[model samples]
Target chain A: DAGVTQSPTHLIKTRGQHVTLRCSPISGHKSVSWYQQVLGQGPQFIFQYYEKEERGRGNFPDRFSARQFPNYSSELNVNALLLGDSALYLCASSLAPGQGAYNYGYTFGSGTRLTVV
Target chain B: DQQVKQNSPSLSVQEGRISILNCDYTNSMFDYFLWYKKYPAEGPTFLISISSIKDKNEDGRFTVFLNKSAKHLSLHIVPSQPGDSAVYFCAEGGATNKLIFGTGTLLAVQP
Candidate 1:
């Protein structure tokens, strides 16, 4: 089975532009989470959705939002993007929220690199 | 303020030797601690995690130690291999179920 997959491996947007990144969760998985990783830093969780409802949210502003589709895929939308939004947007999937099976462990995809010009 | 922190920017260890990575957090509400290893240009992959209930947890060659009082944790890889080289991050989980991450430490295992 394939791991979590994210779309548009790279993206560029203007300071005031909006950006949307997509992710497909692993088969049979019901949870999808979004994270932003700045250069040289670890990932910070943005949002987590389970069963199409918001399960958790990070300390980000309203400019950052996300939704989970019926298929467990997710989209992360950032409005009025800022230069600091330049980072790798990662999508991680698990069997369920709160760390998943965590035995074989949680899986992460090659993230979408977003650069705000 | 950084709730989670990895003071060491990098670590170098010889192959077959032991590799140790450290992390610290300031939040008293953090109930879960985790270690994620990220390769350049790739997303972080969960390495190992330990709940606050236990001071120690182990999986194969990887072990995590948490000192709640000190707000510190450490990851140990025995007989470290060159393949283990990567940037390791420390994360803390709280009521929000969101992960707060540190700056990460680049670990290089010398052949």
Candidate 2:
């Protein structure tokens, strides 16, 4: 079976431009989460969606937004991107919101490497 | 303020030796912890996890120990192999299922 997948493995964009990253969760999984990993640092949570609803959010700025489609795929949109916005965007999926052991050891996708020049 | 912290930036160990990675957190509400391993250009993969009720959780070749009193935890890998070289992350979260991660520890396993 196919694991989680992300699109546009890498992209280069100018500052102030908008970017949308995509993700497809595992076939049977109902929850999808987004994370941002800066160079040399661990990933920070962004947003989570289950059954097309927003379940959780992180400490990121208001410029970041996300949505989950009925098919369990997700899209993370970053508006007015800054040079600091460059990082790896990861997508993960799990059975459900209250089901995962710690809500942490998720199955992650390879990630979209976003570069804001 | 950083809730989870992995002080060590990197560690080196010889093949077949024991490797210990440490993590500490300041959040008492965090009842669950997990370890994830990542390679270059790849996202982190789940390694192991432990709940607050238990002080230890073990999997083949990998084990995680938690000390709730001190808010510290460690991951032990016995007989470390070259393939084990990767960056390890410690995560803490609870009902929100929103994980807070540490800076990560890079393990370099030598032949």
Candidate 3:
């Protein structure tokens, strides 16, 4: 079985540009979540979608938004990107939403390394 | 403010020795704690986890101890092997279902 997969393993964008990162969840999984990991720091949750609905959101600003597809895939979009937006964007998938899925631990993709200059 | 913290940036241990990594969290609402291991260019993998209701949880060579009073948790690997070397992160989960993580600690097991 394939694990969660992310696209464009690497990307580069200029300040004020927009960026989109994509992710495909594992088979049979209905939850997709996005996270940001800066160099030398742990990942911070951005958004989580369950069954194509926004289930949870982190402290990220309006520039960050995400949507889940009918097939359970997801896309993370950052508008007017800033230099500070450079980081590894990770996508994770789980069986469902809520504590049960969280307790099961999320399966993560290799992540998209986004560099904004 | 960092809700989760791993004060030690790195740890080195001899093969076959025990390795311990510590984590501290400030949020009392955190109900579940987890550990993750990552290699370069890869996402973090799920490791062992423990609930706030339990003081200790073990799986094979790994054991996690949680001290609720101190809001501290520790991961112990016995008879560590070189393959165990990697960056380990501690994460806390609350009602939001989102995880807050600590700055990872790089562990190096020398042969």
True contacts kept of each: 0.69, 0.78, 0.73
lDDT of 3 by residue, A1-117 (tens): 999999999999999999999999999999999999999999999999999999999899999999999999999999999999999999988888653643568888999999999
Best by lDDT: 3
Native-referenced DockQ of model 3? 0.75
Query: How many clashes (backbone N, Cα, C below 3 Å) per candidate?
Result: 0, 0, 0
Q: List candidate 1 stretches off by more than 4 Å.
A: A99-105
Question: Candidate 2's residue-wise lDDT over B2-95, tens digit each?
Answer: 4899999999999999999999999887668989999998878998999889999999999999988988999999989999999999998687
TM-score of each: 0.92, 0.97, 0.96
Poorly placed runs, candidate 3 (over 4 Å): A99-103
Error of 3 at B56 (Å): 0.7
Clashing pairs in 1: none
Overlapping backbone residue pairs in candidate 1 total 0
Ranking by DockQ: 3, 2, 1
Calculate candidate 1's fnat: 0.69
Interface RMSD of 1: 2.1
Model 3 agreement with the true structure over B46-103: per-residue lDDT tens digits: 8899988899999999999999999899999999999999999999986787888999
Per-residue CA lDDT of candidate 1, range B18-63, in tens? 9999998888876678788888777778888888788999999999
